[model samples]
Target: MSGSDSAAATSRYSAFLFDMDGTILNSIAAAERIWGVWALRHGLDVASFLPTIHGARAVDTVARLALPGVDPEQEAIGITLAEIADVEGIVEISGAADFLRSLPADKWAVVTSAPRDLAARRMKAAGIPVPAVLVTAEDVAAGKPHPDGYLLAASKLNVDARDCLVFEDAAVGIAAGEAAGATVMVVTATHFHPLASPHPSINSYETMFTEIDSDGLMLLQERGA
Candidate 1:
């Protein structure tokens, strides 16, 4: 990690919050394949539409499009089923599995825009452990770009949202983390394009290390320090 990344390292957090898809795992290929088919069926330009959906609930994304004769809720349900059925391209982000395993199970949570079943299936396929506190779309009335999920995850972990470090990959997820008052770390392991953000950013967890102090506060830093 560079000196510019020290902002996140300087904090002692009680818990860690993570966004699933682009943060800990890469589901973009499978997701875009399915969504592409749906987009073409709806007369949308696949190339342009796919990028807008990451880090957001499928229902929320679909509802925002306002496609004629489309019921957002039903479309989202179908998309979820397809995603669950196809984990062909799903894989962990660089060092994600080992990094997650190192954390105290109760001190971290996954707050995702995906539904619970789909999230579980993807984590299993990627060989990442399903976290103890997994907050899914169904658990919150609203999704990313709203602080509801992250805040709820912190609540479930018995910690303050401000005392957690959030790992996210998309603009919406980052917004959600910040809105929840958590320190945000941008994970770009699965990014398809460059992202510019003021928050500390890392492409992989390979060189990152974590320590838990006597008071149970967790600190994340580059290895070999």
Candidate 2:
């Protein structure tokens, strides 16, 4: 194996809960398909709009697509529906399925910004099982950056928030996990700048992460011991 590949395989962690989009699945293709439609309908250039939508929830996605005349909440539903229908480009995250299957299911679950329908469609398209506990947009009164979703996931797992480890690709999701009293792990899907919006920059486990796996995902962090 190559030097870089060697370092990746040796990475380790204790317990892990992975995020679906961007983190464990490459959803840009399907997301782009839906967002592109939003951009065109709003007269905005698709390229310019894609970056801003990376970490946003459906309400945020819809709000941005709404522009001035449209109601953001109403438009978010359309975007959500369009996304569910546009499952053409959805795929599992890099090394995500293998890593997930390699680990025990009771120790992990998926926490997503996408609503139930969209999450189901994408998971099916990506050939990944629907996580035992799905904390979708419908589950949380507020999405990421609010901590509700992460908190609920940990609670459902019967694990203390501080004992849970979260694998998130978005700054908001990371913030949510951290805020919910859990250890937050940042998967380097994009440059740090996007995540630079918040979250303390972490290089080691210290008080932040118990340990991160080869893929930058935290594992075994939620152990009760």
Candidate 3:
């Protein structure tokens, strides 16, 4: 790694905020299946519709593409219900469970654009324990790229937004983290569209480990270090 890259990775923070899907949980397969079916049913192009789905609430996606006179809210609810029942391929991102388990529960949270129930179901399917502070779509008036959810999570954790590190995979979630004044780390573990941010990025948590210092400060480091 370059000097600047190493420097960015070694930076410390008081707390961490994470996006659920694509970051902590690998729900891509399930998401694609559900959204693809939904798109076909709506007479929309699956390829064109999939790009706008991630990192945003289903309701928002529906509102953006639903045909005239289609109830966006109802359509979103149907998608959510279907997603909750469709956990066929849901799994925790590699090393996500270990990384989270090593941290003090109070020092991290999940801020997702999914409804609470759907988020809970996904986590359960992936065998991830529900985080102590979960900011779901229903909890915020605005979704990702709005900063409401991330800000709410930092507030709940009693950590300053500036002292929080955020892990995300989607552009919208990165925007939210940046807007909330947190250092955003893009997770490259999944196949995601390119992001234009200059934040440090990680491809896998598998070779990383967390340590708590004598001062009770936690830091994430590479495994061999």
Candidate 4:
């Protein structure tokens, strides 16, 4: 579903919603280092468990595992603290900063499964600007795979969810966006392998560009178009 393969190449939306970690920046190395250590400590297979942790809140991911003697909330706090302390290897997705900068600031929001502090830190570390409207894990009663975050972001932007476009990189986040009634665009900048999706996708923001019409609607399209 690369940009060139779909009608999304010329799609226009009133606003854009973006996921934080995998969508706007590459935090896989830092995340895996911390989560991998925690997984080993819990007697879980690092390789098998790491993939499940992305695109959702730590508490939700931990609770879903239902590990014996583990308090999901407490463990999530510990993990967040560790993540906040380690921003090493975090970098912006190619052209992410420039692409975001090109958009009207009020026309976009960042919806992330990461807690507020961690999201801010990671965005800062990657040199990505923090959006004025950010819906973090704590802001919503539920994380991705639920529409709360994206819906809230749309609400805060004073736009209809259906009129917004969501940019995401994980299944749960994509589900959340769709649940919010937004068209989704997948970002595979951090993916180790190709992703299969019906939604339009881009390997990096470098492949796309933004335009604002006279009516102020934002258009997302392939670079040369």
Candidate 5:
């Protein structure tokens, strides 16, 4: 849900947790280009695969779509390498860099489904600052929707899960954030349709404002209010 009142009501999150790919980085085109190639190699339908691919790890996605003989780990690694090299379409999500800059770096972290190396590469490619505490696919036994990554990120930031706020663009990531006991805010760029979830959402960080007041961290609407 979004509007002047909702944005005005959003304030005082202890810490910020962000999903990388669709939330902070606009890597959908790059992802589709690489995953599409891998899908064809395995004879999987791209149309059916794209919907389930976002916010999921390569290994998990490979396991879900791989043919009988396909080695999930090997295919996952291959796809990771391809994505690292295919940086053509990778770019920072609008207002991402500026929003992050407004926060205390120690109070925010990136929780991504991408592996450590790939996540780093994408952040660098998009000119987004890499967080000191990054929870990647390899850092967790499970990925989004399980809350492991988000929990780990909060722990690493030395913040309580309930005190955290998460920004995400996929249903799985949203589930993870909520499961982690944080308020989840949906980003509408990657998610084309209206969000049906209960959480508040913003189309971009451009519409939001961050301020550190005596009460702690507060996020407000730049214009909606």
Candidate 6:
């Protein structure tokens, strides 16, 4: 969806939840920084990890990089920390800061896989302000691709899952939103040319934003009046 599409989507709901990393923040530099270091350390295939772990959690990514008996968790964390340390290059996506600032604080929140410190670091590096409610990996027993994180964001917003909409960068995130019963908006953080994506989603900014009921905006949109 284009910027106009975001205006349209926002007019349709009461609450909005955003994903960090590829969705609203550009941390590819930070990620690549970390992964490349890990790849060098383990002599593992960096190319394979790139295609596989974009939206994946650190623990999961690490566990998947087994090299004929190499442990995944042990490997994934080493990469994640290195990535976290060199986050000087993180930046917010175009229009992300503007859109976030336009919404009411109470109506929006962030749900991300980053542990709190890393999330803060990336947000700072990107010049994106942290929201009132940020659901991190520490907050959930399960992470993305699991409905736990999305559901947690909705709960914090004090809205029903049906009333919440989510913006995401990965298939796992889209799946998680669908499971949570929130509308999912997909972005190109995971891949470029979002319009050509085989996945179905809302908005071209590739965002799913909702009004916080200010001036009855959300309600008005819902009634289609």
Per-residue error (Å), model 2, residue 128 = 1.1
TM-score of 3: 0.93
> What TM-score does prediction 1 earn?
0.97
Worst 10 residues of 6 by lDDT: 216-225
- Provide TM-scores for the models: 0.97, 0.75, 0.93, 0.96, 0.93, 0.81
Q: Taking the tens digit of each residue's C-alpha lDDT, what string does model 4 give over 149-215?
A: 9899999988999999899999999999889989999998788877777888888888677788998
Please give, for residues 84-162, the per-residue lDDT of candidate 3 as tens digits: 9899999988888887887899989999999999999999999888889999999998888999999999999988888
lDDT, model 5: 0.84
The lDDT of each candidate is 0.93, 0.67, 0.86, 0.91, 0.84, 0.71
Candidate with maximal lDDT: 1
Which order, best to worst by TM-score?
1, 4, 3, 5, 6, 2
lDDT of 2 by residue, 130-201 (tens): 777788888877777788887787777777667666777776777787787766666664343544533322
Candidate 5 RMSD to the real structure: 2.0
CA deviation > 4 Å runs, candidate 2:
1-15, 64-66, 189-225
For model 1, the superposed segments whose C-alpha errors exceed 4 Å read 2-5
Measured over all alpha carbons after superposition, the RMSD of each candidate to the real structure, in angstroms, is: 1.1, 7.3, 1.9, 1.4, 2.0, 4.5
Clashing pairs in 5: none
Give the local distance difference test score of model 4: 0.91
**Candidate of highest TM-score:** 1
lDDT against true structure, model 2 = 0.67
